[model samples]
Target: MFICSLFFIYIGEQLDVEKNLKKTAVLVGNAVFYVPSIIKMTTIGGIYLLAILLPSFLAGYRDYTIGTDVLVYGNIWFHNAILSNNFWNYLEWANNSSIGVLYATFNYVVSRFTSNVHIFYFWYSFVETALVLMTLRKNRIDIVLGMSTYYFLFFNLTLNILRQSLAMIVIVWGFNYVTEKKLWKYLLIILIASGFHSTAMIAIIIYPLYWIANNREKLLNVFVLSVCILFIVFSEKLTVLALNIGMLNERYSDYLMNSNIRGGFFAHLLFCLPILILYLTAKNNIGGSRDSQRYNGFRLIVAFTTVLSGFNLKYVYLGRVTQYFDFLFLLAVPYIGNRYYVKIGRYRDTLVTKLLIYIYLITYWIIIYGVQNSGETVPYILNFN
Candidate 1:
């Protein structure tokens, strides 16, 4: 956390957007001259540019902190023997119980290295962050606004949420496949992703709804209402099904009926209000009439996640599931912000033009400083120190 702060300060001082953007162009599909054609949110491309670069380089360096998942997963390495005869025993333990096969297998395979835990953490953070950054940019979410939310809100999560973080990465790409109308590709990807975390199957559940959102805008209002009702009614059954399938941790069984898991209360508030405002705005402005299927896809994802947030308010584990889907907010916020920006004019440098940046900063503070689980990052330190 400390080191990250300094890095941010250094970034604030030394980072030059215009120069670095051109420098990083080849890395970002080499769209240098095609800026006007490619851009959707702000013309600046600052946020998308940062998302593309920041996590791949910096995420692996963070030290563990209080309330962080790192302390738990990192220690798993020290507990497991490298190539021990008992390795299969550990596999049996995970497989027979609730741990998804891929995560368990991933841990065992990576643990072959002496420093597998740190390596695991690093590679996981790198791949997860990179996938999301590329997805946002590919989907044409305003790079600047989307990336701002990525840093403030979602970045720390890649440091934690060890398993679902991977699943989130898969679904972000799955959205691109969804937009492209590649049916088999979408199904195959989401199924494989579920192996990392069972909650990812929620992607499958919401996939049909995504079609409804994009193809039938007139049905959108009804579909949106149905999603809300369907989720509230079936979320528990879905939770039970995931438990039975071992997609979720069996340890969370108590939370199924437990009322104490008032998780994501504030987070839900943060996600829902903006989503409602945006949904209404989309409905009123473009509504079903808008021609951009990408925008429709964006709206569907946000709405799906927003309804999931309501379920999250009921239970923390449910909220965790909601979170994997809710990451669409990173893309959706910028879309909405860009829509607003378009009303006034295209993405601009004016403070009023970039208000989403400010909102993201405030959200960043709330998550990092306010939430117990969220404030999990510590200064960067090699695992051995």
Candidate 2:
């Protein structure tokens, strides 16, 4: 699994070749102008297509044991629950599950074509990874590094929490709209994303953070600090209120009530410290640029996720809430590594910082996926029989 992820990372970086080709064309005249065009073919020409395909194929071909939900939930829905002799009859079953109407409808439609779960897996993985890649490309961030983060942190996650994975990706794509101040469009995207997973509804709070980041930066900082204290003090009352108000379902309400795993509070807090320091120091580095604004907006998002991390101290399910925003770290860490600097005896370089960031992310992957076996995705299983 790790080797395949590394291979995908290598191929994903090939996206940089497009920019290099464009530069080469200008320097060498029309001789190589069409070279980039040939690569741009949507079918399979560019490295971009190959990058998306390899991971999707690997994910799609995985056997049931490869992920916790494959045998338990996803394949069940794709093969039986959403399939019926008459397709329309399964809507009642679909509507009964926690799944959103759109995703259930998607499964029902796919089941009509065939009951083979592998094909369903392939198409779903394809769309999910494609959205991720397209979002990185659109943001003009480092696609290679963004993909590296995704491969480490999120790709295996998509294998288990299938529905929420789609929701999380949609919300990640919608982060740009939040920065752009597109209220209705962003809200609509959130609404659509919520159809995939109810947890995505929490993302609606992000735009307000964007507003406060731009208008009241100091207050945002104070709020982040206060969040831990307040949540710790009133965690029970807040959980009850949220459940009574229908913000959380019965399942999560029960889970929250039973959750006593409070040991990771400090670990979560420690995780936010370096990131908070990076945001505070690096703001002035890219002063007054659009990237600065976007970075500032995402920093507050990190802050918001920190507050959710605080909630996880008592109500551990808020951990899922934090996962929706994890992709931003890919953007934030790389941007900080490239842009943040320090003066050391009149010598300064970001190369060391970038290398450190890579080491940290890879170590995180090893610990969470390799050691902890998150999502039960450590042993990559192939379905060949």
**lDDT by candidate, in order shown:** 0.58, 0.66
> Residues 276-371, candidate 1, lDDT per residue (tens digit)?
555555322234434366566667667666666665555565666566556767766666665543234453433443474456556655654455
Off by over 4 Å in 2: 1-45, 85-88, 217-249, 254-274, 282-285, 342-345
State the TM-score for model 2: 0.80
Q: Give per-residue CA lDDT, model 2, range 1-385, as digits (tens).
A: 4355546545545534554443323234545444454444332234466667778888888988886667756887787644476655666665555556667777877877876788788888889878887787687766666677677667877887778789888988877888889999998988998888766776766776677667756866577546544544455566578778866555656543432222245545544555666666542445566867777677877776676666665666555556656656756666677666644566566665556566766766676667667566777778944
The stretch of ten residues in a row with the least summed lDDT in candidate 2 is 255-264
Model 1 stretches with alpha carbons more than 4 Å out: 1-68, 71-74, 77-81, 85-93, 215-228, 241-249, 254-263, 282-291, 311-316, 338-353, 371-384
> TM-score of model 1 relative to the true fold?
0.70
Candidate 1: C-alpha RMSD to true structure equals 7.3
Best by TM-score: 2
